[model samples]
Target: MKGLCTGLAAAAVFMATGCQASEPPTQVVYRFDDHRYLELKGWDCEGELWYTDTKQGVHSQIASQFYRIFTKKFVHPSERYIAIPWWGNITGGFSVSKDYGQTWETGGASMSPGENEPDGSNAPYYDDVLSFTVVNDQGFLQTKHRLYMSSKPFDDPRILPGGSGITYTASDGAVHHIKPTSSGPAWGLDYITKQGLKEDTAQFKTNYQGLPDKVPEVKGYTGWDHMRCDMGVGR
Candidate 1:
């Protein structure tokens, strides 16, 4: 419930907000006008990859170190893979681990110790940041701009083939559901919002197209080309 887009009308006016997709965003304005409740990042790991829970002050056995994170839900899809929307880049993109989180890949580059080649040159990036979740072996990428689905352990941040018709719709002061296509992932009831319908994927690309592609770098964090290791990329 923390990540659901709610109270947009109760907050500041939903003005003409904009952001940059290629670098860290400095102007992303949430429709709710309350940023404290947003679930901006999430992380998970497996035997092949490990991470540290800084709050607990214990590093995972799979890796010698871990990074700080604020997660809503961190789940394991398989023994060899983990996925998360690294800190700060919530809408920027996703960080994926094919080797049990020992390393992470994002924006088409490896965020680990020279683990894999960067492959996201053509991928659409987000910076209004959101969250990631898995259900029934399927990966879901949620951003302020859109919601996307992919096979578990996402290979890219782009929307999976046949991912469409997934949007937030509100009616009668409650939520509504439109059955998803076969290839589309089902929406979690928790994300339902009464403030607005069609918020999930409405004008997705159109909204992103208004933002800049290159995000400005965040100080003391990994650049767009690297894994947000500091945001808990590895175990």
Candidate 2:
């Protein structure tokens, strides 16, 4: 009789520990500023992108099924324009928001007049894109072979005549130049594998000290469990 009671207690403890391990930890993926930032609520580096704007009283899932290693986001200094360059094995394109992420538009690359070759195409491939940045009101996408620039906020990107090494002003009022490279933005370098999450979490605590830790009421959040990352294979 005593042995039976001991076995039942051990089983209960095991079940409790399993339940606790299943819950994901919330993490701040990126910080646009002190009040506005992006967070992830999944295991390790796989999760969705949740935007939090404390000043505006807005918190919602702007993008779903976000993997930190593959996806990269660029926000204008003014926070008005936002772009996310997504690449996958079967499909690749850009998701752009011109009005502070109220709405989004996704499509293939559109080249300016005289930018495309006679036989070449304007379709952007996943492996062709190396890096992307938003400086001032313009967007620049650097591919494996050429550097494209769009002055009208990612409408029709054209090849830069000078081809990199040109200076431009950022949202911080600092003059900066673009250096063409063969690699994309280094994601997940500061956290996880590179720097331990403990260190990164401490830095976030210092950076966003006094900021609200409560999750705001998302207007249209159906449920985090229902959200799935189904953009492509290997996600």
Candidate 3:
């Protein structure tokens, strides 16, 4: 009887530990506003991107198998457009949304210039990308070779012509010229209020500290393990 009781107690403890171990760690990486934010759920630096919009009562996974180190999230000032550029060991792609976070489409633009061209001609090589930013509802990918800009309200971004300098017509029926030196449009995240930034920072710190020590095992072949994993916040 004593042995049976001991075995039962041990089983209960094992079950409890298993339950705790199964719960993957989660952290709020970036906050667009009080109502909208981006979270990471999985292991320490490898996970999926989950977008939450409290105002719309929407909580959905935007992208999967995201490595926090190489992935970045960009938002328009009005929160109407969001873009994510991610890279794996051998390949990389973009995931974009036009109507906020309602829906997401992957593989819109290519980091390699002219890859989208039908014949795959002109600058067929991959550009050494340095940074990506969104300004004036447009996405800009700065590379060591040249700067690539997308059209306004970037849902399906196509690399614009003329490299860093280009003249294009705005949706407002006005012709606008962008020079390499011109810097009128500011970063979309810059428009976020100070209070919002403060809250987001605090929340991130709290969530990060609470992450589990052991990374939960991901079942099945996700094909994302090759993605670069490092330590950093997804901006």
Candidate 4:
């Protein structure tokens, strides 16, 4: 039977904020690498998010508003909450509403946010940009891979806890897994070409360890189940 990681530590990526309008509307033209796919963003008078993808072969639109878009987790020293990011104007960020989304407050820190708190490890970016804001902290717009955990994990790869990032091997019994970070939030099925087998967790090591000798780049999407393996995570 398929399983999921229990407890908050394993499923913590869930989270997000923010207003309908005051500054007209903002949008993003998500033009992919393909020849003719141009995406446009818009909001209805009632403040519902909409999009239209136009291409030579396929032209389509989202018929309704998304109640909640992208989400991330938020935790203070004491309490925890989910933050939902939405779109309004061409600009986008968190939307705050006390009576659900019946009414919205535009252009606050949650909307027009600030930069993430400076971490010395975070060197300079090409540009100083703010991604999203919640409470006092801001979560930047990241273009990283989404690592969804597997249900029947021999050991959940999402949580190694404290000390430092740890590398792992799946119970699937493969040649091995090759990835960027030893640990993050995933149970990716990387195809390593090396030959070996060890079930003991102690056998896995963390570092600049390389992936298998020859593996094609991973493309497409992934879901919470095996049926959607085409959607695998990361390279």
Clashes of each: 30, 0, 0, 21
Model 2 C-alpha lDDT per residue in residues 1-235, reported as the tens digit of each score: 9999999999999999888877766666555557766666666666666766687776766557754533432333435665444435212334555566555544422333221322254434556655555444345554555544433332111112333433446556878544434211221111111112122222222221232222122242222211123323222
* Cα-based RMSD of candidate 4: 22.8
- Cα lDDT of model 3 by residue, 148-209, tens digit: 44433311111123335445555567886555344222222111111222322211221112
Candidate 4, 1-235: lDDT as tens digits: 1345554434454321122222334333222223322122333322233322233233333223443232222211100111233332213333332221233334311221122223321212323322322221212232121111111112233234433434445767545543434433222111111222122232353311332222112243121111011111111
Question: Which pairs of residues collide in model 2?
Answer: none
What TM-score does each of the candidates earn?
Answer: 0.27, 0.48, 0.53, 0.19
Tens-place lDDT digits, model 1, residues 45-88: 21122443333343332222232342433333332444444444
Q: Candidate 4's error at 39, in angstroms?
A: 4.3
**lDDT values, one for every candidate:** 0.31, 0.44, 0.47, 0.26
Residue 123 deviation, candidate 1, in Å? 9.4
Best by lDDT: 3
| Superposed Cα deviation of residue 162, candidate 4 (Å) | 48
The local lDDT score (0 to 100) that residue 108 gets in candidate 2 is 22
Best by TM-score: 3
Q: Tell me each candidate's RMSD, in Å, in order.
A: 24.0, 18.6, 17.3, 22.8
Q: Comparing 1 and 4 by TM-score, which wins?
A: 1
User: Sorted by TM-score, highest first, which candidate order results?
Assistant: 3, 2, 1, 4
**Of the candidates numbered 2 and 4, which has the greater lDDT value?**
2
